[model samples]
Target chain A: MPSTYSRTDLYAEVQQFYARQMQLLDGGAFEAYAETFTEDGEFRHTPGREPARTRAGISAELHEFHKRFDDDPVQRRHWFGMMNLEPQDDDTIRATVYALVVTTRPGGKPAIAPSCVVYDVLVWEDGELFNRSRRVEHDQLFGSAAAAS
Target chain B: MPSTYSRTDLYAEVQQFYARQMQLLDGGAFEAYAETFTEDGEFRHTPGREPARTRAGISAELHEFHKRFDDDPVQRRHWFGMMNLEPQDDDTIRATVYALVVTTRPGGKPAIAPSCVVYDVLVWEDGELFNRSRRVEHDQLFGSAAAAS
Candidate 1:
């Protein structure tokens, strides 16, 4: 189906969606963050790694992955910019954004994690946008490939 | 005057404006970057300090500030997120955004500078958006005040 939304509306919608999604994740609301994705949404943290498929699986994986931070809690803020949005005929929008994760320990200076480029497939369902899939490619891991691109 | 654009258009316009503006700055196109602001634009890198007033001043200040990188160049990426835009009655828009500056030296890991919240007053002139004033508040400097907000 053709999208009823104008280009401006689509872009704003996606921007707001990611803003809220990242807030949920950074706030440690894994379940709420996972709900921002489709029921069978797939998230690939790295290129070849097995994806954490499905909303439940995603939440569980996040919970386990973040356990290491339990001893020393650091507030993580995901900042995204230079987003390019492309709308497809199937009503899915492809969004590629540069992401920088900043971690701030209490009373300590902020630190930057590896920079990443994230590619996401977003769909509108019932007047709300949801992530169908996301693949993150880290710059350090793919140095030359990332730099060339 | 009321805005001619819808909320969605205004949001997307600001997003694209910043995306291009930041690219210009990071790419070291100081003159082009300064062009994104008004002729009499005011940029306060921090609160209470004398602002880099006017487009020419902004360009000059940026050029001088970036000279340190000449000896040991580092790629600086400014990632912005969680942007909030409000259209004012005076035909201007107030935008607040969270910005994280990531710097990467050659063959070195990416480093995060202090996290900052930027407040910008933007106006439309000649069918284009331009920044009239910008004030940045860094989390480390403000500490409790930033965390509270």
Candidate 2:
């Protein structure tokens, strides 16, 4: 918390940071989405499972993951909800969010995104908010779910 | 926070509460598991999709949901992780846990359980930790995921 920190304000700002990241990712602005995090920010989807740890890495991962989406038959969307914020230290707050990833195929209903929890850390830097770290806890056996795909 | 509440102690206690609940649920001890909640505990899988409220309701729902499992060939396990606690007020703390419900067949590898977030409101009542309410945020489409089964 900063000298001028407002609890409500900070929470709201942190919530919007998620919105910004979502928009950029959805709009195909992978680099912009990755910039939402700090230079040393981390995004881990499962404990001890972080594919990317920096903006460049995030961008590269996103590219490799989604660049093929256009060729695939299903469309995907990431929905994050149930956001709760807790102050962790002087400069950072942990934001725990529920993520719903939906995939839709032609002439079919939207499939619920897999179950996962995104534990994100947002920090204040020079009066701006940036995601410092994010760990996504995926509920999947090692190769159980992936083997299906 | 209580007058004598140690952050470390309370956190550990809360962590154990989750462990106990998991143990009971995994062991088919539905009634005992439901006892972990207060009289008016609420179990909502989605924000607006609460099918059961109150301890008795929770017990009833669990029985109805699980009674059929014993006759099936598959087995289930609930894995909870990334538990983050936040103080709600004087008497309650929110335990946000990432849950992965895995199922395995007799001769198959363990499958990824559906992905969901368990938002539990843990209350300190007369020195007992009771789950006041739990909202399970399941990221699945209405019937797309279930239709597969």
Worst 10 residues of 2 chain A by lDDT: A102-111
Considering only N, C-alpha and C atoms within 3 Å, which residue pairs clash in candidate 1? none
The candidate maximizing DockQ is 1
- DockQ, per model, reads 0.24, 0.03
lDDT tens digits, residues B96-136, model 2?
66566777889997764465567888888788899888888
Q: What DockQ number belongs to candidate 1?
A: 0.24
Q: What TM-score describes the B chain of model 2?
A: 0.85
Q: After TM-score superposition, what is the CA distance of residue A117 in candidate 2 from its true location, in Å?
A: 18
lDDT (tens digit, per residue) of candidate 2 on A76-101: 45667778888875767888888766
Which candidate has the highest lDDT of all?
Answer: 1
TM per candidate: 0.61, 0.53
Model 1 stretches with alpha carbons more than 4 Å out: A143-149, B1-4, B13-79, B84-96, B101-112, B117-149
Candidate 2 stretches with Cα past 4 Å from truth are A1-149, B45-50, B142-149
lDDT of 1 by residue, A56-80 (tens): 9999989888999877656677877
lDDT of 1: 0.83
True contacts kept of each: 0.34, 0.00
